[model samples]
Target chain A: MNDPIEILLVEDNSSDAKLTIRALKEKNLCNNLVHLTDGVQALDFLFGRGTYADRQIENKPKIILLDLNMPKVGGLEVLKEIRSDHKTQFIPVVVMTSSREERDIIESYKLGVNSYIVKPVGFDNFFKAVSELGLYWLLLNQPPKL
Target chain B: METLSIEHSISPNFTKKDIEILKMYFELSKKYNPVISEALTADLADHPLWGPLMKQQTPEQRKAQNERSLAMQHAAIYEGKWEEYSKDLLAQGVMYAQMNISYSDWYELIKMYKDYLLPYIKKDFADSAEKAILYLEGLSKFIDFAMYGIAEAYFAEKNRLIQANEERFRAIFYNSMDHMTLIDRNARIILVNRIPSHYNKADVIGKSILGFQTAENVETVKKAVHSVFEQKESSVFDTAHLAGENKLYYSSSISPIYSENGEVNAAVIISRDLSLQKEAEEEVKELNRSLEIKVEERTKELRDVVKELESFSYSISHDLRSPLRAINGFTHILKDSYADGNEEALDAMDEIINNTQRMGHLIDDLLEFSRLGRAELKKVTVDMRVLVETVIQELTRVPSERKIDITLQQMEKVTGDQNLLKQVLVNIIDNALKYTSKKEHTLIEIGSYADGGNIICYVKDNGAGFDMAYYGKLFGVFQRLHSASEYEGTGVGLALVQKIITKHSGKVWAEGRVGMGATFYFSLPKPRK
Candidate 1:
């Protein structure tokens, strides 16, 4: 197992998360993809608190895939906290969600999201979108040295 | 008669010395006659009532009248004959009546006679002051008797004149064109003149006025009559009557009549009918009320229809699309996992996915079309040139390989909702670009001009033009002249354009020739100067 998470995916839907992980694996990009079902656990992992208190803070993921609609501690609130704190400000956060509403897109960009992607209905399109995004953020895109 | 005259003398106890003084007084009067005569004649000539006639007399006749008045005053002072003075004033009163002089003018003339004699009497009796006092006392008494006689004659003449004038006024009052009624305090009609053909004097007179008027009028009349009696003042009110099918209106005035003690005893009510005027007014009021009710009903109906449309739109957005997206997603998954090895199964899955996707797009477009109707217009001055350029730039973003020639002419500024007009331009220009994709060198033109008192805007395209015979279906939702294979469209674009144009109080139309080209035109009213 990897020592630190390379990617953290915060999504409430199980099928959507499985499909996303499958796409990244097909591209051989998921060496260490940490999937959390809701925003609370995702925040716990990122800030090294709650269930993830034993983990080190410096082992933050290279990128976060956040879904806007969730049961507790929604994606926007998590993004706002990540941006305000100096420890996680530079982490490349991308919004990946099923909502294609203009208001949601605008709010994600306003919160300094690195990229926004609308989940396509067809599996083929979804697979292509997730894989391309994974390849771009993990491989081609540069992150600050940790 | 001569003894009676002597017995009626002003002073029978006159001494010989007093008689000599009187003879000298007459001589002194003659001496100052020229000086006193002009002032006396000028005063009478300028009198308000008798001036015109007196001014017409010759100077000699005026002097003679003045001399005659002075002689009469001299005889009254010398003999104390007040009766002769009274007789002279009576003769003057007769002359005053014949000349149509006013009572005020007669009084003023008598005062002038005394003024002319005062200085002459003073100068004549300067030697014997005691004789002067006696003569002046006798002169004042004689003038007082003359005044009493003048008053008696003047009033008799005044009464005769007033009687003649009263006869004329009576004729006018009784035969006036308008109906006049006099009612007592009990709301009883006491006198009614110029009665209509259907009403006799006996029918209206001594009857309760409340019977002739409507209930509302009766209340108004009662209030007006009560106020008149309480305040001892006059008040007017309008009342209406129904004579079979005809409606008669009248304006009645209530005035108080006071008895000998100066206390109000009764009221006089005068009514003037205004049925024609009142009928016209009532008709107009009824018309206005009915029109207002009609407008209110129409507005309610329109609101109900709008509410229904809004709910329908809400269901389409929330309920229909979620299931469609699920079907499309699951079908695509099936095609990828199990059906990939079977070409027929894969094809069937692809068909389901495509149909659902089309349905989703159609729903979105329909929702937008409905929203446009309900959207509040935020009007601003829109530059059509910038709007067109922006829409074209957006449409050409993907970079089509087909050579496209786009021309933008001089466009006018229009006042409309910026977002809505932007949508209108986008839909139209987008159609132009989509249809012309098959052409080798497609030409699209955008321009505007002033026509028919409005700013006319148009988009022309060298694209797939349809038969004019199918023009009726041009802007109908889901309507299509061509099949999906020939040209792809949900058929809501033109209908949306029509709706948006209609909302702006503008008009939209199209002209086309099959296989040649088509142009869509819309007009907006120019901003008021």
Candidate 2:
């Protein structure tokens, strides 16, 4: 719990989560990364509530890779909670999902999401997209001190 | 004088000298009455003014009328019945006037009667010149009295006719349903027929027209009245007035009434009430307003339905594709991890991957078809010849040893959404290319022609054609006439073509015979000039 969180991968589908983790691990950006299956666990980890009450809320992740469709709590509501709170508001949130819907993209931006990416169907394309996103956000992107 | 003196005479004011002169002339007139009457009748028949009237009478009727005239004259002087004679003369004058005889014509006829008597009186008094002159003067005075009576009666009859005409116009002026008033140049109401229900006749007759008008309409009425007088032309306007508890609308027409000297002395203002018409107009407006609201409500409901459909398709695009992605992703992983050197397992995993990829394509195509239903058409002139060439170029770009020939003929331009029209061409041409793949020489012909109000384009192929029996299912969604082994298709190409063409207010149909050939035709409205 004291390890500085590098990436927070919030996705419900296990195969998608495994593939995303593998893609990032190949790029060597998966260290200190934490994976949450649903938006409730994601929110709990971000705000130090419920199952993650012992975790420090100030020790926020460098980036949060969010999926729109999830169980218990949806991605947009989790984003709203993350953005509304001053402790987790500055953390970069990139919506990575299978939805190419205009409304989903618009809603992500409207809720102050840093970036939106539609997961590709082909394994090669999806691997490359995840690798590029991990390198850009975790390695290259400049973040404010949180 | 003693013979002329009479008791109970009608003219008791006649002097003894006047009686002597009248008695002498009456004696001479009685003796020569027959001769004088004949000459008078002949003179009237020849007189230019009376010739037409005298000729209308028979000779016997003229003779009897002349004798009756002499008898009446004889009774007036000899019988001293001047009152009766004057009354008869007045009645005759009225009768002549009614016959349209002019006053000058009557005066000329009287002169002829006196002229005929002068010669007779001269011949009878040949020795006494003084006595003859005196009788002639007295006869002149008697004729003058008769003239006065006839002229008075003629004028009285003319006055009666004028009064009758005035009465008729007065009846129309007062009995009319409209509010009629005559106003002078100063806008003072001089005369009004049928006073308004809101005012007394006395209040309206001599009051300024501005006083009766409401504050808002005073200027309008004043301007109309002023224009009629100043321009000497009629003017009209609409005005509203408050009468008791009700407001009334009126359309007033003010016309100049010209005097005899052609001057505009007054204006006749006729106002017709338009409150009922205005009320009907308001009711119609209210009805239209309610109808507009109903249309707006229906439109909002339809918009909500379209929004729901959009969200449904969005969910399908997202939720359906996620699982397919997982399946395709894990299958590749399994083929890489466990299927090493096992061709059967690797082949089975490839099959699974292929099917998952195919499912993704199906979801995309389905979402696209649904999107076409909601997309707004951006209409422009689409050149079909260039569009078909472009679609053919794209569909045939895949490298293959199979020889394909596409013959594109002259195409008429049509008005439609350009991108949608391109999709239509791509689908039909792609189908043509696919169906003709088995032929030794694949031949596809694309052509268009004008048909009445539409431009019909057709794609012809010479390859594996379908039986006409299944024509009804040709363009239906997922309804394929050929098996996957014969041809590879998701069966949504022609359905997409139909949807696009239908959106452009066009029609699509296909014709084919087994083992022969097939032709797909689509019609679009011609571009407006």
Candidate 3:
């Protein structure tokens, strides 16, 4: 857990979160991954607030996989907070959610999201999408140094 | 013999010598006045001018006229009141003229009196011939003076009548409501009824009308004026003037004024102000523009609401699929991890997986059905025959040993969205194939014909037909007459076909009888020639 977090997954549904994590683990990209259930916990972990206060704030994740629909603070608001701050603006934020609504896609891109993906209904397609996105963000895409 | 001058003058002057002779004649005429008056009054009854008039009078009227005649003669000769006698004669002349008496008739009556008096003058002075001539000349001069007085009265009365008529025309010319101007062929203002508020009467009287007109209207006004003069006809035109900040409109009508001998002279132009009407028309235009803007705004609002509803349905389906995916994924893992060698657990897991898959298919169909409503239609002329054949070829591409027969009748071309029309044909013919699969020999016929302004196409199949009692629910969303176990269907095929057809301004209907057969009909608008 102390090794620098490489992937940050933000999802409101627990089952969806577990499935996404499992897919990443199958690809062996889940070694340094952190899963937050909602947008509030994701924001707290990123800014080192609340239960994450004692953690090192300078330790940044390689990519943040965000979901759009969440309770008590949504993913778009979290993305807005992340992109607006100079300290975390360089983090690559990938929006992966079940919503194929055009508004959500446009808003996420307008907030400077690195990539957007619509989670497929079939488990095979969903597993493949998550695994490829994790492998690309963690292995292929070069993130700016914080 | 001294002859008197008989000049037709309104006012005649007499010499002193004529007065002396008239004095001598007056003394001689005094003795014979009674005889002359009586004889003249009796002769007046048969006179051409006075005969009918005197005949209608009573004897008392004749007696009064005789007495009046004697009194007038006595006033002239014996009393020497010639001034009074001349005044009375002149007054009577004016009265007669006012009563419409012909001047010839009045002159003839005067001559009758002179003829009667001449004989008496000659009889009184028969011994001295020179004296008789002198007295006769004086009497003639006296009668000429009296006639001169009557003639003067006639001319004065005529002049007064002409003056009255001139006054009447002047009143009308000066007191008109419209701005009436008299212009010559050169478009110069000769006379105007009302002067413009900005110009003096003196300044406008002789000025060229083009000077007063605005630049835009000068040519039009000049042309109208010249046309009226040349064509000898009236012309009307419109003109606009910018009066400071306000724009004034006027309509001028120019009519030719003919002079004597039928020559076109000056033209009179009457200009009426039309600014108020122009302003009213502008206001109506502004109102229409605002109304159009309001209608456009309302249409935009309605479009936004429709867009919102579409996105709402799209997101709901997507969200629903998310949970189903998780359930399927978790169940697959559970069956592999914990249900090994356990028949009951494996069967339950398989059931869960199958139902979840089914639900996923339903949601996908529902989303697609909703998307059809918002898709922009791309209309083109589509050949129905080619489209049906292609659909049939594709549906029957999979080789099977079962005997299958498909008959495609003649179909005319129609105008619609090509892809949507293809979708409609595929759905209907596929239903035919699916329902008729249970039969040993499958018979599916697709045909079309021109029905009024539309091309009606129908698919007939000898397959599992539904009861006619549920015909009302044929094209409704998710309304299926058959059980899913008997026929694997999402029940959205017919509804999708209905939506597409309705969007093309067409209709969809079906007829069926249980165990007999079923026919599905759809109509599309004919392409414009």
The digit string of per-residue lDDT tens for model 1 on B187-266 reads 78777666667777788888887888776777887788778777888887777886766777777777787888998767
State the weakest 10-residue window (summed lDDT) of model 2 chain A. Answer: A137-146
With a 3 Å backbone cut-off (N, CA, C), the pairs that clash in candidate 2 are none
Best-to-worst order by DockQ is 2, 3, 1
Q: lDDT for every model? A: 0.78, 0.84, 0.82
1 versus 3: better TM-score goes to: 3
- Per-prediction tally of clashes: 5, 0, 0
DockQ of the candidate models in sequence: 0.13, 0.56, 0.37
Worst 10 residues of 3 chain B by lDDT: B1-10
The residue-by-residue lDDT of candidate 3 on B1-529, one tens digit each, is 1112223323336567777787776676656655765676687767665666667877777667656755765665545556656666667666666655777878877777677777776677779898888887887887787777877776566566557668886787777666688988788889888876766788888889888778988888878877898888898898776555566778888898899788888999888878767788999999999999999999999989997887678667667988898899898789877887899999998888878888887887787788898898999999999998899899999998768899888888999999999999999999998898889999989999999999999999999988889988888888999988798888899999999999999999998888777999999999999
Candidate 1's displacement at residue B71, Å, is: 14
Q: Is candidate 2 or candidate 3 better by DockQ?
A: 2
List where candidate 3 sits over 4 angstroms from the true fold.
Answer: A1-6, A36-95, A101-117, A128-146, B1-267, B340-346, B389-412, B440-443, B447-453, B527-529
When only chain A is evaluated, what TM-score does every model earn?
A: 0.95, 0.97, 0.96
Poorly placed runs, candidate 2 (over 4 Å): A12-15, A22-28, A36-62, A69-93, A103-115, A121-128, A135-146, B1-177, B182-242, B249-267, B330-352, B408-413, B449-454, B525-529
Candidate 2, residues B295-395: lDDT per residue as tens digits?
99999999999888877887898888888889888888888888978999988988898888878888888888888877899999888888887887788
